[model samples]
Target: MTKMKNESNLKVTFCKRKSGLFKKFSELITLCGAEILLLVFSPTKRVFSYGHPSVDEIVGPLFGYPVRRVEKLMEVEEQHGKKINHDKKVGQDQRWWERSNKEMSYQQLEHLKMSLLNLNAIVTQKMLEFSNP
Candidate 1:
């Protein structure tokens, strides 16, 4: 009975420390904008982690501590995903446009050409309508 009680107390301490570490990890990530992954196994054989992409994806390749390229690729992937998700949410949603009435004026000639082509189509449509009337 004493051994069981000791084991139980140990478990409770382990759980509390694990939760505290997880919270600290999250806070560090939030404050520093660094990609971090932690792998912890308790005495009872449990796994825990905290990271942006994942602990394994970040840490497994170079035998712990991912190379700079890997971290950069992960960041790019995350940014791309965020952009795609934002586009999906903002597309056809006038609420976003209403909040930020902004447009990027940085233009490429290719984009300008496409815009001109669209304008031509609209002009042609209007001319056809007038002629028909």
Candidate 2:
């Protein structure tokens, strides 16, 4: 393994090494019937995963992780159904103008005004910079 001094170099090296490692793992699984689950977290905290069958299927059963029950699944399905119905009702109930120009609260209006002012100031500054430079 080559040592990398810089963050950019390290990230590049990590990607190369990770790809090689996964290739070897795949070969091992195909030739030797070895079950494998590999999980690597990058320097940026992004996850990289490789598994023979699947990461969850092998790890969950081996580690005695709790599997979802029928009741829990039903509850999730019910919640999703409610959300879909509510969304449909909301879309159906509102007219085009009502949906387009939503009535903002006093606080929301003030927040919007301030945001617009800040954006205007930034644009003015950029214009001045461009004109001068």
Candidate 3:
């Protein structure tokens, strides 16, 4: 791709592209429970980032470790895809909340937290309505 010479055009493109990058990362992280640290700098040097849980949580492990992009991670995930789907199908057969917390993966636990929070809000709203009515 050629460098965008127009300053306004460059900034607009950067803004749009960074949003798309973060959206894809959000979807991928939600799908596979993959931890990613994406640090993006805009044309004006403003920082943009998105991290599941938190950026510190993902970055903390890198202190002693060397940074190596593992191609094997993709291959391993590809092989596990079918097994993961099968497991999820079986899991769906059982009532979801009935499953033990210890058996849940990180993403599952995050989902459970969000679900519980939403339930809490609904319960609180109902309680207020009932009391007022």
Candidate 4:
């Protein structure tokens, strides 16, 4: 009976801590003008989540775990801006590979290089089609 009671208390403590962390995350987002989405699964496989704007919209992408779509869209806009201001491209946004180099291990660097090569191949194929047409 004592062991069962201790287990129940531990579960309650876990729930409270999770709720507190989510509340703090919400406050930070509000104060800093940021968007955040979080998903958590308990040991029992129950789900808890929080998202600024709406939980429904962010749900699909968090589950999929790609580089959040909104962030990618912003990067596209920044790249367009840089293209237009090619002569004065100071302080332009950095690509993912550029930003990642600071802390990347050697293995990660090699992987990133391979991914960049793949991206170049895809882009070159599209460019070839444009040129031929």
* Candidate 1 per-residue C-alpha lDDT over 1-133 given as tens digits, one digit per residue, 9 for 90 to 100: 2434577888888877877787788778779977886656667864454555554355445344334644565466557545544655345442332122134222223333343344344334433554675
Q: Candidate 3 residues 10-30, lDDT tens each?
A: 988887787678779978988
Best by lDDT: 3
TM-score, each model? 0.41, 0.46, 0.46, 0.39
Say which prediction, candidate 1 or candidate 4, comes out ahead on lDDT.
4
Q: Over the stretch 1-133, how does candidate 2's per-residue lDDT look in tens digits?
A: 5667799989998988887887789889989999897767678865566666754356557645443542354355457545544554344542221121255445334544454344344334433554676
Which parts of model 1 have CA positions greater than 4 angstroms off?
A: 1-5, 60-133
The C-alpha stretches of model 3 lying farther than 4 A from their native spots are 64-133
Q: Give the clashing residue pairs of candidate 3, or none.
A: none
By TM-score, highest first, what's the ranking? 2, 3, 1, 4
The ten-residue window of minimal lDDT in model 2 covers 93-102
Candidate lDDT (C-alpha), each: 0.52, 0.57, 0.57, 0.55
List the candidate 2 regions with Cα displacement exceeding 4 Å. Answer: 1-3, 66-133
What is the alpha-carbon lDDT for the whole of candidate 2? 0.57
Query: What C-alpha RMSD separates each model from the true structure?
Result: 23.5, 20.6, 17.4, 19.5
Clashes of each: 0, 0, 0, 0
